[model samples]
Target: MKGQSRRRVLQAGAFAAVSGAAAGMTGGRATAAASATRPTSIPSARKSGGALPFLEGAFTPATKELTAFDLDVTGKIPRDLDGRYLRTGPNALGLEDPRAHHWMLGDGMVHGVRLRAGRAEWYRNRWVRSSQVAEKLRETYPGSAPADDFACNTHIIGYKGRILALQEGGPLPYELDGNLSTLRPYDFRSTLKSSFTAHTKYDPAADELHAVTYYPTWDHVRHLVMDHTGRLARTHRIPVADAPMMHDFALTGKYVVIVDVPLTFDEQAAQAGALVPYEWNHHHPMRLGVMPRTGGTVRWFAIDPVYFSHTLNAYDDGNRIVVEYTSMPAPFYAAGLGSGGPTATGAPTLDRWTIDLTRSHVTATRLDDLPQEFPRINEHLTTRRHRYGYTASAAEMWRAYETVDGQIPDTKFTNCLVKHDMLRSTRQVRRFPAGAGASEPVFVPRRGARDEDDGYVLSYVNDPDRGATDLVILAAQDFTGHALARVHLPGRVPLGFHGSWVHDA
Candidate 1:
């Protein structure tokens, strides 16, 4: 059979099997399934036999929805700062089998901190209400029903007056209010026919949002663009051999960088009940394609097989396209999402790939040897040469767990936030407290700022000792100095994926 027909058959078989299983289950079993899907107040304490690394420490989910006003602040918040810092991540409420729970398979929970005129207005954390969540809470489903009812976790951003909670691999974006309340599943006013991605690049020059999205059930991915008015303006279908997990992509002045890594969908793994059924395939060729932003034939360049979760930035430099990102060795090699210690290829590092248009070749280089991930740069520099980039230390984040065989010791911890000066070939690090962990650093440029680094870096630092998280603001130009301000939150904010600084309009 052809690949498309084979995929359709497989999907049908899986659906039938699930339907049969549900039909055959007793009332108790049905109750159990419902219970498993509900969000718990807090994660249970770690078991004596060893627990999942993500379930403990800073990765634990907040117990309940919280709303706090007049947040305590240390130092002074910039008077010019005005907007909300919103983030979302997997926060598992209840797990039937904690041992089998993957870090990326949890319910979606969004955390937000509102800032205005030098004051921390409020901090709120709310779960994005999927159908299951709404059913469990005995409430009506919010907004338009999604094509799929999976949690829209991973990243959150504000675009065209809409705050969207996004996820990868086949879920629609959930819309939230300015106060972080789940409004409904948004689909560009019914313009989107396929799934949306967790990451979307905004081109200020064109006033549009671009994304490369993928779904496991499809044999191809799509390049989607939304106009400045929040309308789905374009969709380009790109064919591929297999269903690759394109978690994130990059956008430059001329092209949208589509990375096809070694990680592909595993039908066997899915049938075997793996929560995240994608794994590394040694046989799969790793490559990247650069497609013209305005839509044209894609230029493909083969690269070494590797994995990366996020891209810092990409831009055009003469005839060469420069892309900087965090490179990892493998995915789910040991178990779960980035569980187990570092692989033989070493920890995740800041790497660069220069695609030469003239030579039709790609040159890979290591920009920084430091183990780091969750890279961010000034949004104003998107699709342009940028001087500074920021990343959270991955030294402790990824190496926190021992191998499944228990060969290495579990020394789970969090480290510093880093500022890299690409032009100067130097970096300044700001280490957090001993037991504290920080989320991805978001760079918010000052209003009417002249230089690229003239902004404030914002992060949610989880302080285990205090059982709370703080939104830390650092002067971008003064990287190693004391924080400009720390807005102490009332509850814990788990280490999450990505977020954006939504400026007030």
Candidate 2:
């Protein structure tokens, strides 16, 4: 089964199950009616006396979408660089319950900086107008209606001459122009019938985009492949016991790595009023599935229970598959996204999992002990052996804070960017100033680059002292050396998820 037929069957089954679950959870009342009275964010049970951590400081939501011209630059901007650094994140208009707000729930706002000929051309931000946001703005909804009215606020990428703001689970992607203006909800020309994933690995060999997508209402996940022409080429549904939250996946030359961790959607929690209703389940079996890219039954391997939100890269090495990611040893967001900090149990670390095909065994190893997240690598080496990997320091951003005198004083913390020399078993770190934080480091290969690290690492660093943000560029080969350039912006670009350097075509 493929295309619309397969989608209809899956949607029918999912709707039935969702209806039954909602009825059971809400005593047969209409789901919409039940949801009307409940909080729009998370439950109030975990509400604190002060503002939520995600809504304060650098994570604060931007009030209006603005465009600035001719950004200030501290150092020489690379002449070869000509593109836009675009990122999307949750920026709420207004919360129904501020104390119960989850960090992950909000309207999507995209921030972008355009670079051309050694000059910072412009910096602009625009909200991806969902139905709710459109109504609030008194404008008609753009494009098609999205699934469940959820905003695409996780990652933004340029695919086939189109800028797409993406998020996992259920919702379709919101297409945007180069200026970061929302065009419409894009569904690959109406071919993507189920859902779209935020993280899609581009297979340079096949000239395709590979993704593992899951919907909260479905009990299975789909491995989707889009051909070089940006049309759906293949779809394979893989079943699981519970509806797991498969945020990201790994891609190798031969296999698509499926991480079926214990984090699952909870209907009860959703009915009881949790905006982001996924919770970690200890009873759920933690396993990994290796499925052939060509299509076949998945080979499942049981593993220790651990959650990883992002994967650096994976490759087929002889008879084994090597995977590296930022691993969270304990369950996270059990209550809600903003209920607790990510470092409650411990800071996440860069870890590796080696799966042996012949022995049908898996081994886990810690590559670096330092806390890190949002691992990235050179796109040219994706799905192949790579010498260098980059990550942002995760030590300070999500640290827990205590309320004092009905206020949670902002805690000053510093972060850094790391470069790992995988083959040499060494690493280099570049620490930021106190009260400063950096987003994910995006590697952009230099024009006509030769070596693997012959490129630049770009990140949006927020400086609390200046109350502004800067697009910091560093020579990837230099590792910890001085920055190549710092494009200063007028305001803070909130800490966001994955982004990419969309080169001019």
Q: Tens digit of lDDT per residue, candidate 2, span 1-505?
A: 2233222222211110000000001111111111111222333323445445555555556666666778888899999999999877776775656665455565787878999999998887677877877776667775567544456777888888888888766678888888777788888877888777878899888898998988766778999999988899899999997788787889999999999988777766665554445678888899999999988999999999886767899999999999998876666653433432222345567899999999999999999877678889998888999989998863335453223222433443337888999999999989887556778899999999999999999988765556677789999999788899988776667656668899987
lDDT of 1 by residue, 319-427 (tens): 9999999876655342343441122234667999999999999999988876677899998889899999998863335544323433443444237788999999999
Q: Write down the lDDT that model 2 would get.
A: 0.72
Pairs that clash in candidate 1: 40-93
Q: For each candidate, give its TM-score against the true structure.
A: 0.88, 0.87
Distance from true location, Cα of 356 in model 2, Å: 0.2
lDDT of 1: 0.72
Question: Local error of candidate 1 at 432, Å?
Answer: 1.5
